[model samples]
Target chain A: MPVANMLIERRTFAKERGTDLIQSDEESPALTQEFMVANRMGIHARVAAQIVKVASRFNAEVCIAKSDVAANAKSILDVMSLFCPYGSKVFVSARGPDATEALSALAALFQTKFGEP
Target chain B: MINDRSSLTIRGIGAAPGIAIGKAFLLERGQIPVPRYRLFGEQSVAEECKRFEAAVKEAEADLETIKKSIRSEFSDHARLLEVQQMILRDPSIYDESLRYIREERTNAQLAVIKALRKAKELFSGLSNDEYAKSRIADVDAVGDRVVRILAGQSRSDLDHLREGAVIIAHDLSPADAIQLQAGRTLGIVTEIGGSFSHTSIVARSLGIPAVTGAEHAARLIAENDFIIVDGRTGVIIINPGETELEFYANRQDEIQTYLKQISRHSHLPAQTSDGHRVGAEANIEAIEEIVAAKDNGAEGIGLYRTEFFFMNRVELPDEESLYRDYHDLAELMAPSPVTIRTLDLGADKLTSWCPTLEEPNPALGLRSIRLCLHYKEIFKTQLRAMLRASAVAGNIRLMLPLISGMGEIFEARKIFREIQAELTKKRIPFDKNMPFGAMIELPSAVAMADLIAQEVDFFSIGTNDLIQYSIGIDRSNEHVAYLYEPLHPGVLRFIKQTVDAAHDAGIPVAVCGEMAGEPLYVPILLGLKINSFSMNPVALPRVKNLIRRSSMKECCRFVEKVLRMRTASEIEEAVSKMVMKKFPEEFHVFDPNWIGNTPLAAKKKSGS
Candidate 1:
């Protein structure tokens, strides 16, 4: 239900086709924050799904970074490939309308340990 | 046509029960071979790219449709399906496949395969994290669906599958399991899976006979090859000879007949259209029949006859063996209620164990509870085992059979409590709240129903014995057999009273004897407000369908009409009239002579 109340500030999204989506290098200041994975499962399939649900809620381009380079937070396959484990740090960066809101949602999710025991 | 094929049998796990002999419909899924072909023209390359895009779309649509049909349990896996849908749209596989198609001019199947390989390598990142394997499996699952689509052998193709064709698959996923139509899909044979796999569980739930882990089943059997899937023995015989085919065909007929020819609807819930749910449970003696019971959609084990253990053995079965049997039954039925009927043995059944303990009239002699109470040590051992199982399973219910008085109730309760205290002293676990109850079959028990209701948590009427004792006639006796009437006015009154007494005391009453399973008696029993019924598992589907079509309001009204009747034959005629009006087709299946003067052999003991 946490994702049910999500409000998008703008309707600006990528093109009709996702494969043709070229990441726009925004000159606007981007909001970035780092949080440690607290849940024992870390970023599992269910957790990755939670991240996607939160990230896709905004007009902003969400990017997640783990032990390696950042991957598209909107794409589940991309977010999962980041390989964030328990106690590992993940960096979330977004640029566009409501960038701060997206970052805040990600922060809340990480803080709650993705609702795992 | 069948002579040219190989005569072979594949051994696998019997994940379900019953028999099916039919043409094989090969559903070659989960890892299709990638076909590589070069395109000479740009037009051809573009066409191939369009094919890839369309397949991804189709696969996405398939996931969405499955998500919608996920039913009452939608939320648990709806998000997972969305995640899979996203994988279909992911840039890693989608863009890479498009790239391969445009630049390399490869076929859509080949392009999708190469792209999937690349995506898998990318998903396993820098860290050797343990989460990588399971995460990668998701990618593989999504990849497999796309590949199956590209190969034109997807699960959607199964929608057009001919009725009663046995499905042969490389493997079946939980997603595929969801789309399976129990009535249409006759049986299942998978090349790769275990007895406890999701596919097997689904097949069992649907009451479809399935054999899993049948290696090379798809390779060995071609489409339209006549085959037999024996789910009981886990044997898959491909393209049998004429003699063998005829034998298996007869075997298949026998199974359907055993189930009264309604096996297709066996998996359906016994819920009325008005949303009232009834428990369609099973009564089994042997452990192997538990599989058949579950496959037939038994909600729980209503009466587990434990006396079988003591019947055939020369001596008593040790406490350890009894504990394991009860424990396994409990664990198998986990959250479902399993009512274990304690040691219902008469002098008639103990001929193998104690030859000298025979009574001239065993039915009226010291049997069942009387025998158990007389031999207190043996009874205590069985109680201890059941209590131990109750602790582990958390769903065991103890029932004392043939209890005719409060004196016997107090004695049994005292023994049960003493064992609980002994277990508590030893620091052993058992469900202290485990319900203890009695069988409402004897005339004396029926007379004092309201008073007896206070001492017990529940009541299950054994209609067979209730009729036997109440009418003073033995069903086995040739001359007096005509008096064994289920809907006899007196018997109906007894059932009504027991149900009313239990309801007044806030306890549930169940019917587990022959009267419970008879299709003609469903509406009548439901009218009496007895919602829990335990019968032979084979009769479940037929009886459940009747329960589903009936409403509590209508059943109450019907019971009102029947209460005014004075004879069993009159009630039988009324029930026949109702069934002919409500379900005209099934009216033929019910022997209208059930309560009339034409006596049949004493209940066919095959079911129990």
Candidate 2:
């Protein structure tokens, strides 16, 4: 398999999560990943924006690396084309001032279910 | 007898009014021809290619501007634009155009049209994948638009047109309806389709009459043939012969007179002159319908469908989304009883997130409460939402659809109890006394109603499905549609039995189906001692009008008389005559509450 290391950012769930949270990953960073271009749906615009927001707060140049292609994490369009099937994982690599802390926060979000991850 | 000019009189259930005396616009299926391309010229092919690229860039700019316009008009139209953009930017469309340029040596416009036609070929065969098949419809639509634009036609997108004209299309797409100017368009009549098509929603919304599945409407009716549309009856008469013209003209006059008279009784109580009252409620699909139902004087929302929440969505709705929808519905119909059936999905309504089960016979296979029973987690999630919503509105009941026997009932009850127990543990101040009921549709359930009623709080007979299943006829099947009679002796007996069973158990029985909305069956249902009737809100006023004109005894008498009939036709004829005799002035009255008069004190004072 042509796999490349890409940073996986966590998206949180809104308040009421009963069953929706069940299918999500119980742990973060080591989550199993599937690939399909976000198709037309892209991750919900709000969810993608929130993920970008979290990455920006860490002042790190975030990038999503697929097997052959790498894209800027800040661009919703580029990340969406990566089409991470619902329960797929991508490695997170941030090389900036707040890289380690940003990676940890992203990991915790995935652990919590994207808050519902 | 043919007129000098070739003329054909088409009979359809009419949907809109007025006629235009214009040349007929014949919209043919995939008749737009592909143009030739001339890329290899005496000078240079590269220059021609550069010009084509510039034209494409220009088209792309136009597509973006249209996308923005569509977005401003509709909040969710971006979804459509996204699809359209993908098609416009698809390499296949452009590659085919380039191939035509290289092979046929065609001009830019011709090459683009040729390419789009080639792309149209991709959708020619049906795909086994449902999503793929649906996308085929989109491809055809976008292909037509692209072809039209390349042909130098103005971007007069049908969806954006707000004029009140009858739409003439080969067939309408769901996306087309979404794009339509809600306040404009009179109605749409296609030469194709049956019930549940997208055009039906458009016609219903514009409140104009529509006739679909009309094989060749485009060829037959010359533009604007002084059309008289009666959407309720699904009858369309164009350039009627002498008798026909007179009949419709008189019918129109009579309808206007009836409207005037019904206005007088609009504010009247839904009680007969002799004082037996009937509660006519509304069956709503969305929270928006709640307001329309209330405005139509619905006593309550008898059937609030929950399936819509799950439709057209990618993921399962979390408890919050469910709670918000249910709570909003409850809040809208607050104090009035709102009966919400848990996700009544069958194999036909497959969700990607849920397990897919293939069944040879889906109608008889696992669905409704049965599916919920096997999939407790799905059912439990919905029940939890309902319980939480029940706190917002005091009188919300959880209904189970397609329950056949005691087994399904007990299973649902067990799940209900489990949810209640969980709620109690959480101290969620929910109404434990709220009624729990089963829709008496399956013949097995009707046969065992008395036994089933012993455990349930209420019975809501889903007559549409009940009649179909009981008669062993699929009403959806056009060939057997005539056989799907609601008043068949077998169907009547089943309804009577179920109603009597519920009444004897001191529980109320209501009907929520197309049958409840029909004026012809109102008395028959009343005679069966049904306490409530629920239908589309538009039908509520007319049903109420029928109730006001009828006493329970009189309805019982009519029912008794009709029961003796041997055939469906005989029953229908007898009921029609009776309705004409008893309600001549208001036969199929539209908008009984349109006049907005409160029921007279004398009428309300009379006792049941």
Candidate 3:
């Protein structure tokens, strides 16, 4: 079963260069893509765990790939293994019964930057 | 055997006690390579993973014991152990170990190192805020734990530096120092640090005489040769001859005796032998220093510089918060006088509270009272706080900084009256008769002291800035720092003028500068008709000892001789020698090179 593509905000990449490691992309299919960002705070264990947990809650089968390694969207361990910093983004793809709902949720999460205020 | 000939003897500030002579062990970051994991076989890997997990648990237990041992010494630092615990329990490290053993067939140590390195990289990339920065230490702890787990050693056996051994490191993590047995450790010699570095502060707190900033300190000292470290003077002596060792032994005894003497007289007054009473006060920024001040026998807090609270945080503290801080401090120093100086900010003392201005020379630019006056709301809030605080336990005196003329004094007094009127209208329970004074730190202030004295209750000469302002030299500028002469004829003249002016108006004058508290300048300050001295708490005993040993008449004579000197160098050389000759032990130069950084300047450096 393939999920419908969800419209997402235009994502701007950070100027700083780093690795692209995806932790989650189940919510927003259009926005669930990896990026090379040099964000001040790298993708950390807590951030990775949060993204994985959020993605796991959705019905869409979210798949995140970083570098050459792709892992299930639910594994915190797999997400942290990517070693992405501020400007790195990972490739995200989700296809399932609730793909549109998953994509929309995921896009909102990326836009808000993993809930960091 | 533990006292291997290859062990090094290094000179450092001896903070703690006992002897540790051990083999040379260098804790260098370069030795540890970045670790990587690989896959080998699955069936055998499952068995190895179990062994690795068991080893990690043993190591974790050992770390807990070490944490408990230091729990008392570093009560506030127990949080460090919690971070270490999290690192040890990190799933990334455990999972990586399993993966490596199954796939790469690497040893447990290699796997652990690889896992920890990955974690370190993750934390290192985080933001600079405390939440992220704290995890960096966790990474280092993880590395330490991995080594311990692989070695199959308990934490007790980990700190196995030999007796009287000097451990050299590129830079020691605070955690490493904590794990070392305090009583057995000789000294820490690091290649990194300035005077106030974290390592230095920790060394001071631990009392583990240490000497840092030595270029290749580890490489320079070899196997067990005798060493001498003068932490007070920053002098290091290596492999001293018999006579040199004897000299140092005797010097150490003298220092011990001196410390004992100070401890005995800690509670006594700072009155000179000739019956002239000199009020010795402490300069404090944080309220925590108030405890130290009391312990060190301070009669009062002379300079409660409040700028530290406003620096780098908020634009301005609301009046309620200001009132609470001021009043709380006043209560703490109840019955004892606590002189609260208003928010003294300059371009150099830039804070988020004030907008940064373009001042070619911040030292001479709009600063101190000038900056406050320009910002009426800021100045009034502070003034109101002081007035509110005056009603509390202590006798509160308002001190204005950088007053250049009678007009400035008048303006300051006018503002004070306005605040008092507001408090009166509000019917706030505040003291109406709080004494107000001005700091005579500028040349113009000294020039118009007589006129300004009539409007103020007293005058406190801030000698550090007076020297800089009078000579038009920046004391902080290292190239021109040598020009920061406190005894310059012009500086002395200004100090004398201000002191005399206050005396003429029947008001007392006290030196609240580093000069007033120096052992060498104690006599001169007393002789110049200065009635009181205020300095950092650590300096109280030395200043008090000097005051107790000297006569005001002799001090005046010394001041007379010094005032007659033509040049700044001549005044400095003559005063230092005269005092050393008269009271060699008590009056030696506190810090020969640090002559320019006086008590007030020290506080200024911290706040500004």
lDDT of 1 at B463: 93
- TM-scores of chain B alone in all candidate structures, in the order given: 0.58, 0.73, 0.74
Candidate 3 local Cα displacement, residue B69, angstroms:
5.6
lDDT of 3: 0.66
Whole-model lDDT per candidate: 0.77, 0.63, 0.66
Deviation from native of the Cα of residue B196 in model 1, angstroms: 1.8
**How far in Å is the alpha carbon of B32 misplaced in model 1?**
5.4
Higher-TM-score candidate of 1 and 3? 3
Please report the TM-score between candidate 3 and the true structure. Answer: 0.66
The order of the candidates by lDDT, greatest first, is: 1, 3, 2
Whose TM-score is greatest here?
Answer: 2
Q: What digit string (tens of lDDT, one per residue) describes model 1 on residues B97-165?
A: 898899988888888888788778765544443356656667877888888887887643465564768
User: Could you tell which candidate, 1 or 3, scores higher by lDDT?
Assistant: 1
Q: What TM-scores do the predictions have?
A: 0.49, 0.68, 0.66
The most accurate candidate by DockQ is 1
Candidate 2 Cα lDDT to native: 0.63
